[model samples]
Target: MSQVLSVNVGAGADKPYAKVRLTGIDKRPADGPVAVRAPGPKRGVSGVAGDFIGDERHHGGDRQAVYAFQREDLDRWQGELGRDLPNGCFGENLTTVGIDLEQVLVGERWTVGDPADGEALELEVTDPRIPCRTFSGFLAERGWVKRFTADARPGTYLSVVRPGQVRAGDEVRRTFVPDHDVTIGLLFRATTTQRELLPRLLVARDYLDAETRSLVERRETFTLDDA
Candidate 1:
């Protein structure tokens, strides 16, 4: 069954490896339910209660409110890196198992936990996370950014649709899938390695996060101006 292995949250702290000196990437598993909601118009606010985002200009907001990574992917990285990576090691708010996050379509909706209890969190897949210097530094891996981008399983960012609380062991049910072929993996490729694929993202334009939408719009404008 698809379930949350852990619900993680970070308190802002000093990080020598982080370019910004302070970071919230070292998330730890929460002991109990954590509130989830739409992080208003703020740039760096996190949707998960008590969660912190380090970079205001590049991270968080409504679209990238919550980040999730698959346990299978973490295991794969652990194997490759020859180290033990616990849940939330990648700075994910939710460490999930049994879901193929790479194939989850952009705009796919997931209901987490039981709604009858009135605290099920609803999240929509928004975009694939782009690896940054902080991520690279966190791992202390050589050429980490390039390696992660090349691997193309950058995990998925989610936007909170229905405010509620989530806890570890909660079941995750796919409630909706957009009628577009823009999977997280595909979108990641389009944004990073394959510029030619940018045009293909138009089909899921409405589902894209703000940053990705802007990028697609710029690409469209460039194409038109060039023509």
Candidate 2:
């Protein structure tokens, strides 16, 4: 029952957000159907073509090819923030509806659009996006990162599994869900200030993003016997 409410991409350029400066966060809805392809792990770049990124070191790559935010969640924030939130305002490439981020598992798969219409655009949930200083600045929100982290709804990053065309209103169907308790909210907690949860990420070893997996495995100074 999940569906894409909008598809957005931005022209990358250096821009100012609050006191923090960054680029490629301002996205507008796509004019029409846009090709959705894997940005590839080769070097991680922006997901949508024509969207520029100034932070090559952190933003894009194969593992984080796409970013998605729930329209429902946005609506909630809009009410709380007392501001209207438009699609793509959060820098998400896909604004989705009906997908529960709190329950989303890493390595889950979603098929966007109908295959019969030659639109089997595929995406795999990779990890939850960590809010950055730039994000806080963009929202002009005071302590936004902490607020976002506390909310435990950082949205989700994805990789293109089968690249194709995706457009607004396309149906997003959950094609696969990993059998793990590593939901997006849990993963976000583990990767953020909640370092204690890092060990729990090991449970979804196959699905954990490389960075998270490394953090979990690399931090284990004690051997299994020591535990």
Best by lDDT: 1
- How many clashes show up in model 2? 4
Candidate 2 C-alpha lDDT tens digits along 67-103:
9999999999999999999999998989999888777
Give the candidate number with the greatest TM-score: 1
| Cα lDDT, all candidates | 0.91, 0.82
Off by over 4 Å in 1: 217-227
The alpha-carbon lDDT assigned to residue 225 of candidate 2 equals 46
Per-residue lDDT tens digits for candidate 1, residues 1-227, read 99999999998999878867679999999998999999986878999999988799888988889999999999999999999999999999999999999999999999999957565789999888999999988889999999999999988999998999899999999999889898999999998999878888999999876667899989998988999
Task: Compute each candidate's TM-score over C-alphas.
Answer: 0.94, 0.91
RMSD of each: 1.7, 2.2
